[model samples]
Target: MYELKTKENDRSVVEFIENVESPTKREDAYKLLDIFTETTGYQAKMWGPSIIGFGSYHYKYPTGHEGDAPLVGFSPRKAKISLYFATGDTKREELLENFGKHTTGKACVYINKLADVDVAVLKRLIEQSVRFLQDTYPNNNTN
Candidate 1:
């Protein structure tokens, strides 16, 4: 069985933000905390050691691999803030087209700062990701 490293934990979200090496990143983390909280209507929880996550859902693949993951989350990393979102949603790509300056990986969106992105679009992305996951894995949520 494969283990997921980024499981949710009882660590302090505030303490994690406070320890961010860059003051600017720390401030942005707080701002992101507020935005994500208000948008998701869920209190932030620490995922692993770094990610500030909101809601969670359990997923099982066709191969029988399964795990729980946050609906949406972000980490104020050394180089850029990584935003987590659902991977297979076409709407996610459409929204990212107007999401201001950001880079996307398989499931992570990277941005230099909050100013570089539209907060409204960010909220939509959060909502869409949560909705998609909840629909995909109905009744399996830890929200």
Candidate 2:
């Protein structure tokens, strides 16, 4: 059995944002908190030590691996902010075209700052990602 290291915890989201080394990043983190909260309509929750996540969903693979993950989240890292979304969603790729400046990784979108991206596009990405995950996993594990 494989264990998920980044399970959700009761840590303080505000405290985590307050401890960010860069003042700019700290401010951006607060902004992101507000964006994700208003867009997702879910209160922010700390995932693992760094990720500020909104709503959560449980996913089980055909190989029998199962875990709970946030519908959308972000982390204000040192180099760039990492945005988490559903993997393998074609809609995400399409939206990124008009998302302003950002780079895509295996499962995240990295951006230097909120200003470099269009907030409207970001909200759409959040909505689409959450919808895709809910439709794909249709289980009762969503919150």
Candidate 3:
């Protein structure tokens, strides 16, 4: 279950990313957090234990079940960094093509090392993805 933190245990996303042991990964996470939030104009919030998410959107299924979820986010994983730009196949390969070097698993883009990817291109991808999400879900962009 997602543990929603209150003012008592409030933690900033920057602090959470910095807590990671890896210097390179931590820096990358921090930089990406700034870049994503700035470009996407979305607020950053530390979700659950490790995810630093931006924006919020609700999904409605055919079965009438609906739920709210972060529109975009990333996590500093132990093995690699995971970038989240919503879910499913959003035909983001074009952006990925220009996203320098990285591996992907479904909706999450994984980078084994920060040196393997181009940071500028990654920023573009984030901006584009967030814009696309906001366009698709008019109510999600809270910037």
Question: Which candidate leads the pack in TM-score?
Answer: 1
Q: Is candidate 1 or candidate 2 better by TM-score?
A: 1
Ranking by lDDT: 1, 2, 3
Global fold similarity of model 3 (TM-score) = 0.81
Q: Rate the local accuracy (lDDT) of all candidates.
A: 0.94, 0.91, 0.73
For candidate 2, write residues 1-143 as lDDT tens digits. Answer: 78899999999999999999999899999999999999999999999999999889888889999889999999999999999988768989899999999998888899998999999999999999988888887873445
Off by over 4 Å in 2: none
Cα lDDT of model 1 by residue, 1-143, tens digit: 67799999999999999999999999999999999999999989999999999999999999999989899999999999999999889999999999999998877999999999999999999999999999999999886
Best first by TM-score, ranked: 1, 2, 3
RMSD of each: 0.7, 0.9, 3.5
Question: Compared with the true structure, what per-residue lDDT tens digits does model 3 show for residues 1-143?
Answer: 34334211246876787688998888888787788788767778866777888776665668866556677778888998998875443557777887766888867899877678877777776766766776777864443
Q: Please provide TM-scores, in order, for all candidate models, with all chains considered together.
A: 0.98, 0.96, 0.81
Best by lDDT: 1
